[model samples]
Target: MAIALSQLIAETDQLLDAARFNDYCPNGLQVEGRPYVSKIVSGVTASQALVDAAIEAEADVLLVHHGYFWKGENPCVTGMKQRRLKALLDNDISLVAYHLPLDVHAELGNNVQLAKRLGWSIEGGLEADNPRSVGLVGAPAQVQTPQELAAQLALALGREPLLIAGSQPVRRLAWCTGAAQGYIDKALAAGVDAFITGEVSEPTVHFARENDITFIAAGHHATERYGVQALGEYLARHFAIAHEFIDCANPV
Candidate 1:
């Protein structure tokens, strides 16, 4: 089955409430392609490798969590940017992406999906007062030490997370996927026993130690693999169109 490109984009934007997010990049339809879409390929990022894989998959639209024209990026379409855009244009493939919207969506968002995968039950947003808080506070099925939680993260994400152990075992936990180490302060305010995010900064270790909160830095790419896939499957089921999620592996 096939759906009009406009319809697909509209549905996705509406479902994700893309307009609500103040994101670093545009939330939907970064690149336009054919009038209709029959096969969709979703990935974490629209890197050249993923673009090549999407082309090989014969995808009419490339759906992703990360897309081009990010804020503060050079506007010039040269070098790496030129090659990626040219490939998509030559193949007539549309590029659609969602950033913060995908992270905060109640059902298909990265945060919710990560919770589902790791057996954590979400209690509330990390910022208790903010309804649209990207980070979430939660608890595992059982209380776990930093090391045990690290092991589970390693098994679930296929990458060993960098753990800064705390004195207390993790009872209440907070997590926001993909370079959300900055939210540790918010997590601390939430009074969680531990915090988890992708890509730790140098200051994060000190904060965790001083605050007595366990910190886990799971790989950015590793932790974010599920939301786009879930969105792809939902699209496939909703429109009765073919959808494939291609993981172009990245360590960071």
Candidate 2:
């Protein structure tokens, strides 16, 4: 009923090909707790609220898309960080996270999962030359106006997206989940009628207008809630362990 924590981490690392990505934060086990794991709580981010939820759920491991020790973050454990880490340590719950690796994985990645939910058929990567590109180029089952696409996103994500309408109808679309407005140029180069991401910058509107491509800014947390859940389910089935996905709502 329980598997060794080291084995779980090793299997997950290989499953997501974690080491292949030069991620912003460290992947795999960020905080070690018990030697074995029987239950896992998966979420979009390892926030304080999520940590508390995991503790309440009596989880042995907290699996997340975002974890601690970012590339440029303050190394010191203090303030908010101190409290969050303290809670996990006190509860004896190991923390495991995967960033870009979770975004680009073919089956369980955020982009692919979003496409599956929205009924979009993925044609290829947004950057056709790059095998590791996180953004994807795809199309819905039917052609739709920018407004219609926005409505579909709002309905599916349970959050209304900010729409920057363009002159053309959306026949082809490009998308990258979670703060990927910066990939708009790559989307444009792909000749898609619209680009979708979790957040939009001020200049994103201008680019969409001048380039005649629609832009949609869905919520970052809303857009990326699926991958970690899928990964958790996989681990549970593979190891015969229990998994629960806890959604700690974030309006952003």
Candidate 3:
């Protein structure tokens, strides 16, 4: 069964509460395509590769967490940007994106889904003051040493996390998916034994070492892969539509 593109966007906007968050990119329906959609391809980013994959899948719509026209980015459609946009326009495939909205969705968010995969119990927000903190503080199923936590991350994400050692066992931890190394301070403020995020910065090592907190840098793509898939599955189940998650890997 085909669902109207407008209807799909409306349902997603409502479900993700897209308008409520201050996001760097547009939250819903970045590009309009055919009115009805029976097939959808979802991914973490809307790169040219993902667009090509969606086309290969005969997808009518491409749903993603990262999309075009980021705030403060050069607006001129040239080079890679031109090629990507042209691909979508030529194929008449809709582009829908939700950045912060996808990350922080309590039930289907990336962090929560990652937690489910690792058997973690979410405790609270890493930033207590921010009502929509994407980073989350949580407890592991069992207390683990820094080394053990690193191994768990490696096993779960299928990649070795850059582990910054801490002083003690990790009973409680905090995590955010996709380039959230900056949230480490908030995790430190929470005084969790460990903090896990997608990307790592030079200062992250210094901070982790000084504060004696374990820091884990799981791959950004691996960490963020879940939310879009969860959202795609939900859209599929809700509308009885055909949806496939296209994984376009990025090591960074």
Q: Which candidate is the best by lDDT?
A: 2
In candidate 2, where is summed lDDT lowest over 10 consecutive residues?
15-24
What is the model-wide C-alpha lDDT for candidate 3? 0.93
Candidate 2 residue lDDT tens string, 158-193: 999999999888999999999999999999889999
lDDT per model, in order?
0.94, 0.94, 0.93
Q: Which stretches of model 2 miss by more than 4 angstroms? A: none
Q: How many residue pairs of model 1 clash at the backbone?
A: 0
> How accurate locally is residue 125 in candidate 2, as Cα lDDT from 0 to 100?
95
Question: Which residue segments of model 1 deviate by more than 4 Å?
Answer: none
Model 2, residue pairs in steric clash:
none
- Candidate 3 structure quality by residue, lDDT tens digits, 1-252: 999999999999999999998889889999888899999999999999999999899899999988999999999999999999999988999999999999999999999999999999998888898889898989999999999988998998888889998998999999999999998988888989999989999999999999999999998999999999999999999999999998898877
CA shift of 98, model 3, Å: 0.5
Question: What is the C-alpha lDDT profile of model 1 across 182-212, one tens digit per residue?
Answer: 9998888888999999999999999999888
TM-score of each: 0.99, 0.99, 0.98
In model 1, the worst 10-residue window by lDDT is 16-25
